[model samples]
Target: KQAMDFYDRALKLASTIPELQFPLMTYLGKGNALVRVGRVDEAKRVLDEALAVAEGDSAYGYEAELLLQLGLIADQQKDTARALALLARATNLAQKAGGNRIVAEIALETGRIQRQASRPSEAESTLRAGIDVARHMAERLLLPRLLGDLADLQVSNSRYAEARALLEEASDLLEGLLTNASSPWVRSRIIDSMDGIFLARVRLEGAQGQNASRLFAVLEQARGRAMSELVSARDSSNPAELRAGERKIAALQLKLLRTTDRSARQRLLDEIFRAEEELAPAATESFIRTRASRRKPVTLPELQRQLRADEVFLEFALAEPHSYALIATNHSARIHRLAGRADIRKTITA
Candidate 1:
């Protein structure tokens, strides 16, 4: 999982690359990567930046791809209405741009959202249609996830045999993909990408009273190949500080696209260079050093020693439909479930 900052060059983001080439895909791919790592808001903003670039270039193809990504994000957020609206627009743009591959991608996502909303028949039709298009277009990547999603629908309807066959076919395709992808980084991405297949299989096995641990081992086999490449950054990095710097870089990059004044553009270029130079180490490194950092883990007893008698340490996990907190004092610790995602969002919004 890459960050939004991974794809930026210091200043060479001149004009726009061909929609087929990268710096365009850079923005699009990085946005998708960020979403995979659960950085939802960051993904949205980066995609917005990508859209800005596409609009500047009048590259409607890139716009279609970017809109598809944004729609996927909206789907994750469970804003079905917004997701559908964006998908409809993306489908139109894709057709105009001759982006059949994107249309197939759109169908897969639209189907999943429909499934979530309990429109089973529509979802199945949409997914099956996507699979056909994907096959015709050689979109091997989309086919497995499409299969997995359709399998999920089948499972919901208690069509166990159909679901099992679909999952097995999806798994076989994924295995072939993994076998062909030789690069460690590429293999890691492939493993992450096919998570849906394993998930669907898990559901099928669970529904049929098969051993879930056996399914986990199979899934683990897939993930084990990429374990080294997938190590997360240490907890010491200050996300807020990093986000500020990256946002500045993004703002300057967008400004670089719009400004016609030569010297003003040069100044912006120089600033972006400096900011990128400063941000590079932290952004790329496995561990980043920060001000007054705690680089080493502390045991609970040791952590307790650092607290004042009147004070307690509280760690909260804010999740959808509910939240949780771990409260620890010098003597004791306890976990408490608090609010739903909506309630928490409302409070945060307020």
Candidate 2:
């Protein structure tokens, strides 16, 4: 309410002065404030008014900023095509105005659009170009964001090692920046990116089974820290910090579930299922309950079917407890006797 009142006063003052620069800055400030408050539709409306005024006055520079804001708004609305078009126009206008910072920003946004559209090759190229330009111009603040975006593209493309290296560099840059500033936004972004790298590392390590125990331990420690941060964030005065903490908690939980063992996994899933059951009665009355579900029992023939379905699973599933455990647990005595006959047939064929 206070912000809207201030904006109204500033708008009136700008109208009275007519020659002052307050109108453009005031509109941008109010629009940003609206966005921060989750009033994105209102922000877009305010920015549209600002854009009309700037375009009518031939204020090319301010017009570019408004266009960039509009592109971001479209992105948030999931109108990727519109975001790409608006961002491209913003880039062209910024370049024409010799505004390299805005150009870099548009490039970054373009890269993000490409990434979201599953065009990682294009995203990598565009973001790399933007990062190069930002580096050449010594735009210290923009560099880390661009680098992080590029790393995300790498991760999307399954280039885990490369992504890890890129994220590490970004983390170093952000750490340095955070030391001299109190920006919860930047800190949160950095921590989230670092968490991604750690989770990726855990997945790779777990798959290899090399140092798996150590990797799982590290993941647990990270999860604990992330959850603590989330708890602390509830009381935090900074909204950005709270949001960041929540995101971190979600990511950590997903990573933890993906990395935990079968027995531990079943326990976690059971706990979650029970919690939902308890909450369901209080939240809504028509909830139906059933026995806990398990994976479909795999017979020897079913194993062959699964092998055909996923050839990659053959290498891991054919060996050890996974292969023998199911056969031992689920098969009847007749099926166990048939297994010996099948082995003899395979031996004769060999």
Candidate 3:
């Protein structure tokens, strides 16, 4: 709660700071602050006013974007119907405006909200539409992120082979772009884009833990107490809950990256561990219904052959309330549970 309080204060500060420099960015900050405080109608009115002034080919396009933002605000407020309705309107406007990029953006946003609402089939269709648009436009940057999002949805829906293909495509695209990027900013943006790709791979690893290869297998261990309970409650858990927990963990991890305060970082780490704890690693209904993907793990000799003499391979995985280390060498590989993430964090920050 203290960490959240600090986050709140930071948000308030950011909303007021005039040093943001860019006029559009400042306006967006104010608009977002209004939405956060339940002044949705007021925010909508402001967008409506802006739409009143926009002209020509850009008018409907801008209007579509504003509607998309409102749809996102509705989703945040848990008004799924309102959100989807707004997105539909935005999509129609974007299509009429004839901009493939805006069309793709609305599709992606709508799909994400749909996934959150647990309409997986609809979400998949919407995401696939966006992917098609992205491919048509030759949108190298946007396509990878869309692929990652759909990969995540596929994992949740227990389409492991589909998920694996999408993740591999995204990973390959991202790595290819990293080699092609000409500037530091471009490289950094590409790196930021890999977060979801890595996350989807992690989910795939966890879901296929029983038999899959460790290509992206960081690790998976449940909270000790929850293990027995998890098996008993296995059929009760849903894809929505798993996706929600992963989103929470991702948000906290992002916060951890931005924070410098020792105490606040620890709190965020603790929250991450606790959030992960609730997500015990038992298959959902989709997983139970679908056959898992199969792949061969890299042998110890193969892994060692790829590594330099000075480089030792170590993979850290957040196994719910606790953490673990998978250490590999030329001759062998082993995994052992370490202390909780908070303890490791404290030790590092000390």
Among these predicted structures, which one has the highest TM-score?
A: 3
Q: Model-by-model lDDT, in order?
A: 0.72, 0.63, 0.70
Off by over 4 Å in 3: 1-30, 33-42, 54-58, 211-314, 319-350
- Where does candidate 3 have its weakest 10-residue lDDT segment? 217-226
lDDT of 3 by residue, 182-288 (tens): 55467568867876576567666655554322632322212221243244335444578777877888999999999999999999999988886776552233343
TM-scores for the candidates: 0.51, 0.53, 0.57
Deviation in Å, model 3, residue 88 alpha carbon: 0.9
Model 1 residue pairs with clashes: 321-340, 321-341, 322-340, 322-341
* Tens-digit per-residue lDDT, 7-95, candidate 2: 88989888898678737678888888898889998999999988888888777777888899889889888999898888888877787
| All candidates in order of lDDT, best leading | 1, 3, 2
Q: What are the RMSDs of all candidates, in order?
A: 13.6, 19.3, 18.7
Q: Tens digits of per-residue lDDT for model 1 on 31-56?
A: 77778888889889988887887778
* Model 1 spans > 4 angstroms off: 1-58, 210-350
